[model samples]
Target chain A: EPEVTQTPSHQVTQMGQEVILRCVPISNHLYFYWYRQILGQKVEFLVSFYNNEISEKSEIFDDQFSVERPDGSNFTLKIRSTKLEDSAMYFCASSESISGRARDEQFFGPGTRLTVL
Target chain B: EDQVTQSPEALRLQEGESSSLNCSYTVSGLRGLFWYRQDPGKGPEFLFTLYSAGEEKEKERLKATLTKKESFLHITAPKPEDSATYLCAVQEADSWGKLQFGAGTQVVVTP
Candidate 1:
């Protein structure tokens, strides 16, 4: 079974530094997403990307956050300046289809644990 | 805005005990509801997907059922290895691919 994979399973960064979380979604998948879960909190949606463009984003995905599909297989999320609150487990997901109205299943990666100090 | 709520933040059961976890959602034009299990420091493993009311799916010791407003994940004769955090999420109405998730139900089974 093909699965989504992420790099830098764990990361530690300074409060004002920048960091990039990378993911290589299933090769044939067309839609990608980023979600975060704070300790003891719900998994929160950050953004969705399709056709190399952002489809939707949440309030938490503000000026400091950006996503890019630099190549065919890699999807990345960048944080311009890390904050204490930015520390969390970030998951990368992808679905093989892109029909908005139909039910599509997403495959998730193991996730990257980000720690900001 | 779409929202998902899960009941019983934590649950404990004996090796042969049976129990059910609930997930409630508030969203327009429901698309799909999903159930996943996550172990410590690992990604969520897909369990089931319910697309409409009266839909159900099962695997091993777990069964998932869905309605218009809520869903239930039933575990039968669960074992210690079944212990994990079970999360439920809903794909938003007209959403391209984003998913709104619940706080999850943590289940612990002891032998």
Candidate 2:
């Protein structure tokens, strides 16, 4: 089965540095998303992209955060000037479409663990 | 605001034990209720998606049931391999592709 793959399984960066978490979603998926989970918290939605443009974003996806397809197969999340609170597991997901009944489930990548020092 | 609350934050069970995890949510016109399992250091693995009250779906020893206000995931004769954090999420009518997730229920099944 085709699955979403993320790069840099784990990353440690300085508080003021920029880090990019990359993901290659399933080959044919059209909808992409980014989500984050703190050490012991619920997974929170960050943003969603379709047609190479952002469709929706959460308040947590503030000015410091941005996402881009970058290429046909890659989706990336870049956080600028990371803060201590930015440490978490960032997940990328993709879905072929959202029109099917019980068939449009999102497929998630293994996740990238981002640690800000 | 939409909210999802899961009960019994953590649970421990012996091999072959059967139990259930609860997920309650408050959303406007629920589009779908989803169940996922996650191991440490990994993303959530989809288990089931319920679209309406009285709907049910099953896979091997796990069974999922949904109602208007809550959902339940029942595990029958569970094994150590089933030990994982089970998460519940909801998609409201107005939200497309965005899921409001619960904190999750951690299950530890010992041999």
Candidate 3:
């Protein structure tokens, strides 16, 4: 089955450095999202992208965070300056449709583990 | 504010034992409720999605039911391979595709 795939399974970055997490969502899927899970914490929504623009974002998705559909298949999340608290597993998800009776069940990628030192 | 709360942070069961996990959600307008299974260090794998009250879905040995206020994931006669963290997420009707997730229930099944 087709699945969402992310690049650089693990990343090690220093504080104040920039990092870009890339994801190739399932082919033919439109809506995309980024979520993060801190160690021993719940998965927190970061932002959702559709039509090449952000649909909604959480408070944690502040000025430092940005998402781009740089290409047809590539969706990326960029953090301008990483912090120690930014260390977490970032997941990329996509869904086919968002309206009607077809519940938009998202499929997740393996996730990219970001470690900030 | 949307919130998803899961009960019984952890559970241990012998092979073939059956149990249920709870996820209570508080959202302005419920669009959908989803169940996902996550292994250590891995992203969540989709299991089931419940759209409205009185809706239920089943897959293999797992069954998920939804009510007005909460949802339940019932694992029946589970095996050791069923061990994983079960995550529950909710989407609000007007929130587009953003999902609010719970802390998850970690289940460990032993042979």
| Ten-residue region with minimum lDDT total, candidate 1 chain A | A96-105
lDDT against the true structure, each candidate? 0.92, 0.92, 0.94
Off by over 4 Å in 2: none
Fnat for each predicted structure, in order? 0.71, 0.61, 0.84
Task: Note the DockQ of each predicted structure.
Answer: 0.67, 0.70, 0.83
Model 1 chain B is weakest, by summed lDDT over 10 consecutive residues, at B91-100
Candidate 2 chain A has its poorest 10 consecutive residues by lDDT at A96-105
Q: Candidates sorted by TM-score, descending order? A: 3, 2, 1
TM-score of each: 0.96, 0.97, 0.98
**Which candidate, 2 or 3, has the higher TM-score?**
3
Worst 10 residues of 2 chain B by lDDT: B91-100
Give model 3's docking category: high
Q: List, residue by residue over B1-111, the lDDT tens digit for candidate 2.
A: 549999889999999999999999998788888899999889999999898999999999999999999999999999999999999988777765888899999999999
